[model samples]
Target: MKKFTLSFLLIIVGFINAQAQDFQGMAVYESKTSTSDLKSRFEGNKDITPEMRKMIEDRMKGMFEKTFILNFDKITSTYKEEEKLDAPGQQQSQFGGGVKMMASMMGGGGTFYKNIKDKNYVVDKEFMGKEFLVKDSLPKLNWKMESETRQIGGYNCFKATAVRPVSKSDLRNIKFKNDKKDAAKTESKEKTTSIMEELEMPENITITAWYTPEIPVSQGPENYWGLPGLILEANDGKTTILCSKIVLNPKDKAVIKAPTNGKVISQKEYDETVVKKMEEIRKMNSGRNGNGMPMRMP
Candidate 1:
């Protein structure tokens, strides 16, 4: 009698919800992964059309998303690209290559994760053949973080914004000449020209993080969010994450927790370290294009 009553009430509630001015629909994320011929290593140096830049941006965005299903509680992520591309029976797509170009961009294959404490927190991304784990440099919230309210995945979310100062390491690797030098030095400094000093890493860098306080998890995609519920969007000034699909109240139970063990450091410390290291590497390879430039090896 109790179970029947509960079911009846739920059905009536569903009917009422159906009329609540909005239809309850799950978020659905769709993507079509394709491949093209592998161009020469200087592919980025040549002139870029708007279409090409969009393609690269799409692929970069795709790297942050996972196809795995998640409910209100327990969640898991799996990368289907490897199996789809690496399967022995798969047919070649471009120039007799059966592998996924995106996978190769990363190195071999990749994985994704969520912070146990913050279900919305996500680490950095890795790629196809590379084994080294890449993690998002933690946000130095010393600047500012402001928020707004919005609805996503059938829930209310608070959107926020922040300014992320470029770490010195990132600055060093940004490819700019130190100072004008002799002809002999100029050849080695082709990559580090001084023309880029005027550039600043864009501002407002919107991070549309969603939080409901109902879930209380601090994780989001790619070190982006840690609000109350879940974050469905996090855009730097240039890139963004928007939820296309969502699921709630699954039949299975979920166990939420936090993640540890990463390159934990103060934002300032990370900047100093990365900047110092980048400077060292750049100077060492200045005269050794033989090893500095990209090349295929057996």
Candidate 2:
């Protein structure tokens, strides 16, 4: 009887350990983007005044600085922005609206869900007042791990790097090219120069990520994943996302599920739809203003 009781106790302990190992984790990340380069694009252009430039920079700063939460388990994860209330008396300005429109074109706001075991993902995106459930295969990032290590949030992290293709419409890649000759032809050269005539977008960008093996999970903030361990920090040339806090197996666990509210579509289909919408908007806004000058699409 003693031997049987001891065996039963051992099995119970083993089961408890297994259950503990299958726990979920939540990570909070603070994301910010550098606006220096973006501001430089308008430098020396007669169109944008110092005051207007300051306002544009301020709007970009607010748009890019955000907090996000990543909830993950062994094989699946969900990443989304943490909602925050605006200050009293705060209203959306014209610049804010323009930035929001650009964000919509780039599929900026979304709840991204990734399943490593199935090698797929689903994202909830809102564009032009319509929502889309974008389902697609996970992008395979070829990471090159380096020997460099650092500490982040009490976890030792190793560095890894990868290169990824950039979207043509990505706001980060927007660059303004001013033409002096074109501005000279207009009566209001300052206004004409201020109107962005050419925008350049890069084709690719390099990503640097730091992962902590202590967590022992393949997860990261945003669309980044496939690391051998949990990513604590990641940065591209323009933006950086760093883990601020982490909670393991909290009392209230987040439900990691794919969003099903929007119209189902593949990633390609969603991109095509956005592009078509943009073309329509451009066409509608084309032609001269009442003053017989070319109208700029806001």
Instruction: Give the distance in Å from residue 17's predicted Cα in candidate 2 to where it truly belongs.
Output: 8.0
Clashes of 2: 1
Write down the RMSD of candidate 1 (Cα, Å).
10.2
TM-score versus the correct structure, for each prediction:
0.44, 0.81
- Give the root-mean-square deviation of each candidate in angstroms: 10.2, 4.6
Off by more than 4 A, model 1:
1-148, 163-206, 213-216, 252-285, 289-298
Local accuracy of candidate 2 as per-residue lDDT tens digits, 1-298? 9999999999999998788557899999998877676766677878888888877776676677888899999889999888877544334665654566665543256788999989899988877667779899987899999999999989999999999887544566555555567545643543323233355556788999999999989989877898989999999887899999999998898899988879898878876776566555544444334254332322
Task: Report every candidate's CA lDDT.
Answer: 0.41, 0.77
User: Which parts of model 2 have CA positions greater than 4 angstroms off?
Assistant: 1-21, 41-54, 105-107, 177-197, 283-298
